[model samples]
Target: MFKFLHISLLLFGAVFATCARAESVLFLNPGSTQEAFWVSYSQFMQAAARDLGIDLRILYAQRQPEVTLAQARLALQGGDRPDYLVFVNEQYVAPQILRMASDSGVKLFIVNSALTPNQQALVADRADRVGSLVPNDEEGGYLMMKELIRLHPPVAPGKSIDLLAFSGLKITPAAQLREKGMQRALAEHPQVRLRQLVYGGWTQQRAYEQAKQLLVRYPDVSLVWAANDEMAFGAMRAVSEVGKEPGKDVLFSAVNTSPEALQAMVDGRLSALLGGHFTLGGWALVELHDHARGVDLNQYGGRDRQIPLLQLIDREYARRMLAMGATPDYGVHFRKLSAKGRPVSYRYPFNLQTLMR
Candidate 1:
């Protein structure tokens, strides 16, 4: 009757509306919003998603691996399953999340975190993992060492130049790779002596405490190396309190140039930095969009998703890159996608050497 037709029409309209709703993406960010690096990355990803006409939902893990795993699981188990997921691999949970995504059929992409060989093997045959976008961390680490040695060359033959390092969390692969590069660089420089390597847990406060202890223990420390800018600043603070001038009496260098770090570099408080990894998140969104649209860039070629490091030696380059941040104009690389959202090749448009210029 007329009543039945009215109910049928209403149901059909509801189903149609649900079907027409825009696809959404869920991002699991590793750090708290309080940190500049994580905040910048999250903002960039959101901006890119908006520009690409995709809805984005972000969850912060506050640097806790357990929290990251739980948040991802909760999001996936909820009634509203996102069409795509973007996450960085947290310690001990990368495989679990990957398996979950694969089984749930959610398209997944990793950004900012490198996969281990075992993880790579596990994901090699999986269809859900579109690919990863990680920085060439080894080169980044090598560049950091190169810059440090270039600015502050070896001391006289009788005198030894002692260097201390504040490393990131032990569980992360990026940290491991960067450490590897540092080792490689250190091997070539016999004039420099690595006094100690301390775990800073990738935070300013932790680095501050550790640097304080180390400075008292090794008063003759000639240089400090840190895995990230936050830790570098902390180490710098410690060095300054003890009447040592960074970049003068003592030299310091770190990875990832925050605005503050760059300013310090300009002022001669910090020597150099290796960055350009922060853009990976925004670029990953573009790749995810393409993947959802049936255009797999990885299918076409080799190592297209791996990003490289950009070494910022002076103030000018740092200022420009910070200003560029995660805005739409910064993602010129993604503009090459066709109307169907496929690129001609898998090569990314950015690199360390090119960006440094």
Candidate 2:
């Protein structure tokens, strides 16, 4: 099993003697549609977690936070042996969830975004679990847009921005923080006209429907700022169905270097894509494994449990990502997949300045 090397744990290769089946890790994904964005993320994490010898059992929600909370509460209270409680989508439920885990002796690990000040204080104060593993969303969003501005100069007077937006959940900190960074990026381009910032709600079908409505409402508007690749894919479908070129005719930028989005950026279908710390899920699982194995960091006088890593992608650098395959952290190699999955690189990257008229 490929286990992360513990800097302090004197043990080198096999942590457990060859016999004990690896410790089980439980995952609660927001939902389970094959095409769901989190589903892809969960699969990637599955591969990485397995590589690390985690016997992972996954549970799904009905895309409802309440459903997710119910599932989580049951898992924590379940008869099955429990070690760690991990989640990604529902930030609002975090504090209460962490509180519930306290009595059960379950450790919690969060991913994809940071907990708010209250949640952080509570989690740390209560020894709820460990810190968190999240993307440097502000930096990722900033870098992606920085590349966008560098490559694409607006045609209009002020290099302003417009939006064709979609987000998975308003509660998830990622969408908000990325938007914060993107807004800061636009501060640099004054004349950028931000027309429609419709919320797609993150579902592909809903995203497509929302975008189609926007397309009808503003026939001439082009630039699109999506929250995640799934929405972009939905928007992309809408554009294609309407005989509109996704990237060339209309600008598309989103967070998360999802497979299709990475391919789109490479193929010049998406203007830019900012990477997120999706791989940290498995990395976190390793940490969770360490904790479960009794490698107590707090006992070792180590304070911080949260570890954050970020990756950003855009047209200027999208080619390299496309060529190299976008997902190294998540253990994803796009080229390893079929031609449909093989990443495509764009020879001529999108120029934001040129695209905005």
Candidate 3:
């Protein structure tokens, strides 16, 4: 009986030790919970956290820079400091939070958006800044434009294809990178001409208003490219109001996988859609989980990892995705994707295909 009791006690001790080693992560979401993109991003991360046995907490910043900084300050200075803090450089507010996190001894990871070159210089020597995992926004932009141009080739051999673009806030790195991508695609295709590029502030109403006037100003423009789905929808609305068909008369392209955008594509309204970046948060968690287990992330990728997270969603792809349901079933084994589960030479291929498989 005494021997049996000893074995049971040892098993209990092992279970307790395993529970004690579980890591906690705090994510300061830069967007409000109401925002579909951010909500989906958090949901995928939660799924990953559950699979990896991580304790995850999220705080919404309502897309305000001041609120983001305030939340970071409270989380960093208060008791129950998390083992890691994940955040984005929205509106360039991450520098302040990075300093607070460094002082508080919390490791930091940036997602969605990365630090500016200047900010990178400031934190280049900080060991606590684990790394950044961002989508290839430039590639996303390039693909959007390239697809839009393909869908609507020049009307004639000599006639140039007139284009108009709607970009998000100019300050954000994602927007700037996307714009660069659009420019790169434009450079490659000499037959396409950019009539005007305007900032939509990432809002449907703003893009709608801009589109109304731009369509009149540049009546010959047939290709419209937006940095996000919301702006693309807005542009589509304006095109309809101006008595022009969106998908046929004027082709439109956007980035994001919102249900509305996918449905629009299925219905033959949206021309081109690039999406799947919403999985970044979940992929980031996989990296953090691996790191917590003493695996070096640098071996898989450098300190700043920019992977191709976006894919051009075609009409059939959109239909299939909608059939799956509103929320995507990541169906991914977080453990297998980690460093411990993968081979020594395995490179992380975190993309839509991974989730789908």
Show the colliding residue pairs in model 3.
Answer: none
RMSD after CA superposition, every candidate: 4.9, 10.5, 2.0
Give the alpha carbon lDDT tens digit for every residue of 92-162 in model 3: 98889877876797899999898888987876568888888999899999999999988885567887988
For residue 88, model 2's alpha carbon misses the true position, in angstroms, by: 2.5
Per-residue lDDT of candidate 1, residues 198-304 (tens digit): 88988999999999999998999877888999999899889999998888988898777567776777687888777777667777777766666666575544423
User: For model 2, how does the per-residue alpha-carbon lDDT over 1-357 read when each residue is reduced to its tens digit?
Assistant: 234446324353345543255666777776555643566567666765656666777777756778778888888888874567778646577776776676786767776654687666655665656656666776666666666665554565644445555666667777677677777877887655566666666667888888778887777656677777778888888888778887777777776655677778778887877664555555556556556555554443232433334445655555554554434443342222212222233111111221111
Q: How far is candidate 1 from the true structure (C-alpha RMSD, Å)?
A: 4.9
Q: Of 1 and 2, which scores higher on lDDT?
A: 1
Q: Please provide TM-scores, in order, for all candidate models, with all chains considered together.
A: 0.87, 0.75, 0.94
Task: Indicate the worst ten consecutive residues by lDDT in candidate 2.
Answer: 348-357
Runs in model 3 deviating more than 4 A are: 1-14, 326-329
Candidate 1 matches the true fold with a TM-score of 0.87
What lDDT would each prediction earn against the true structure? 0.76, 0.63, 0.87
